[model samples]
Target: MASAVFVLAPLPLGSVDLAWVCIWTAVLSASLLTARVDHGCKADLWFMVPILAAIAAIAVIVWIQVAPNILANLQDPAWGNARDLAGIDVPGRISLTRSSPLLSFGYYLVFVLGLSRAYLLGIDGWQAHKLLKLVAYASVCYALYGILSQLLLPDTLLWRQKEFYLEYATGTFVNRNTAATFWGSGGLILLIMMVRSILHKSDDADSARVRFLDRPATQAVGCGICLVAVGMTGSRAGILITVLSMVCAIVLYLAPLNRGGWLLWTSVRNSLVAGIIVLALVGSLAMGRISQIGLVDGQRYEVYKTVLDMIRGHTVLGFGAGNFDAAFPPFRPASLGSQGIWDRVHSTPLELVLDLGLPAATAVFAVAVFFFASLITAALRRKRDRHIPVIAAGAFFLGSLHSFVDFSLQIPGFGLLFACVLGCGLAQSISTSTRGLARRAPDWDSPILR
Candidate 1:
């Protein structure tokens, strides 16, 4: 879990990319070792089988169609490497070694499943609690960094080239919004943990590690700190999504489904109270930003509108994946010529449509639907803490909602984090498998058992 947190935690420079490679290498090596140590363990086999099959199928399909162009991109100059395939220019062809169909599918496949594994281990395995702690610690560190960064060096310093992005607070992230997104998601999860701990006071020893959550004042304080961080980032989309996620969590956990019970009314009343509290805090801390967010008649709103136009133009296949960086200009207003150098679509669904076409988009949506349904069903069945799934569900919804305006999830780090949380929720929805540490252990920590 420490290793996982280190791998995913935000870094100040391009070092995060290096961390990604290192973490993946460690994960793969550990998996191999664990299989040898726990010979009878079928955890990896069961979890990986479907993921491998999907990768295999996608690889075959992409190879036949996209191999040549991808290979060409590899050899081409960095600036000119990007091309319009199926209307989208695959992103990062020049910077990355492989761009062919097979590699692309393989990359995304691993990316998705790696997270699924994390989620599975975190939610169902004994490591779930540990993983949550790791996440919280990492988040608190990140929040502290943001606050300090603002205080010590409010302006970008000469040594800090990366600190120029003032629109959002990056903390340890490459982008401010990305940092806030992480913090926001972590905030929601923390809220759930704190609330759950409160509801289970007698299980004090077991919940001691997460005991800080039991205090209402502490929860409120934590929420306040996180909300302020969210506001400082100037991420209206993120702020909205975070609030929505909180609401959804409440609805999923507190709302009653039974025929006759005060649960429904209680849930409603609680929701109203939570909503008021969140609103009051956010309104106080972020009143200025909130006003600006509501009045979105400037460049940002125009960018969103233009993206809508582009999506309409290429509705069926959309621009090819990564093509928006090159394809955005033709759709932009002439006055913003130099301003719109074409970097991103600023929208995830639109990006998807442009990347693989309508069919691919549909396929992605289908997968999301399946995961969501399964999560909701599982959460509802948990006669105990319904809020757990509610929190997960809210984060999922919020992240998806956020993708509409910002491409935060497109960043590999952010994307991986999103996948990890979603996968964890999905895994939780399924069988609640519990394993003795001896029987089920990741490879890296296997030696510790001895």
Candidate 2:
């Protein structure tokens, strides 16, 4: 799954009518068929939640809006892209969700299920490690590409487009920032996996014959490559989030929650060492040209201002999804004249609420809180294995923090990666005896000993 994400991320699907979606449609059909045959298999049910919810939500919203005018429009409904569906349109035929809806309802369904499959099938760790390896390898490859790009075909890359001068080392991606976001997520994931392995002394082995995550030294080297690649991407948001995640992990290490003794001390020590390694690798490019970092900082601040103005203008329902640029042109303060169209608000939650309405935004937020809360609880439960909660909390926290500055979730590739992590965390929790769902409680204070 990780390799698939990494490989496909750099490529553009262009229109919503792309053929790749059909593969998922096939998967969904097969899952249903399998369920019918297997009756009560948990594996089949795992991937259905997000897809089912998205379908249900879209269906309800469409029905509610068109029920009044269904009879009138039944002959020839007003068909159009999803953006039209969300706007203040009259009741009519429900938009075909398969079309480019706000969240690409069909895509999200697949994302949720894929993650769920990783968790239930117990391949989460293996897949994560595999993903890390791909990042490491890709980073190494990108490093070589960066050198070549600087020396040779400096002006020819298509993704570079007109932003050639401003472009940082984007590797295979069209935009430097997008490349950075990709490698940044990869670096952080690699670090988390390595740290977990070293601290817990657990083997990352599984039935799958992947020799990738089992060896410690190889994993560390891969992480080094990824760290370098991420830095080269020159993404402020990615760097910020990576640093924040490390800081959180360090604080967790210092706490005596695990053993409160020498083992705790060792963990903290290891955590510090790991943090230093990450910093050294990521900060290498900035060592000589620290001033450039400052320039990037200013650009980020300007972007933030733009995002704020956008929010202020559309507080009730922010710019519609995929309509950031369309909405921004009018709302943008004249002070930043002709700032150009922006595909993203660079902030996920704000963008989500702005585009999908407050109710939809609230639902997304609830899902995040639920997952994070569960992860934190799992981490503190002492008896539970330390690595699972630690990875989940660290990854989720890091990604969430990063989202404040950039819309990682909006990117199909990163969004899918995140869903996988979330699914793994949820699966781990379920696997543990402490089921999160409400069950009949044992009669409290009804002890026979009393």
The top-ranked prediction according to TM-score is 1
Tell me the TM-score of each prediction against the true structure: 0.74, 0.69
lDDT of 2 by residue, 1-450 (tens): 334543454444211233544454455445534422222235434434644565566445434333344433321133333327667544333222212343444555555555544444332333333443454455455545654564466565535443543445655555555555556555555565565445442232542343565455665676566566666655666655565676565455335344457767776677667666766668655443455556244554666677666555444433334445555555566655575556567777776665555676677677678668866765554333334455557767867877776766555545555555555555554433333322221111111111
Per-residue CA lDDT of model 1 for 1-450, tens digit only, reads 424633453453322354464555456446534422232235444444555554554454444333334444232243243454344465433222234333334336545555645654654433544555456555666676677776676664224655456544666666666766777877787776665544444423443454454455576566567766776776666666677677677666644453346767777677768766775666343456667556343665677777777666545444444456656665787655474345766777766766555666776666666667766875666543344455567777877777777777766555555656665565455443333334232211111111
Q: Deviation in angstroms for 88 in model 1?
A: 22
Backbone clash count for every predicted candidate, in the order shown:
8, 3
Evaluate residue 381 in candidate 1 and report its C-alpha lDDT on the 0 to 100 scale.
Answer: 67
lDDT of 2 at 50: 45
* Model 1 C-alpha RMSD to native: 7.6
Candidate 1 accuracy as lDDT: 0.56
Window of ten residues with lowest summed lDDT in model 1: 441-450
lDDT of 2 at 237: 60
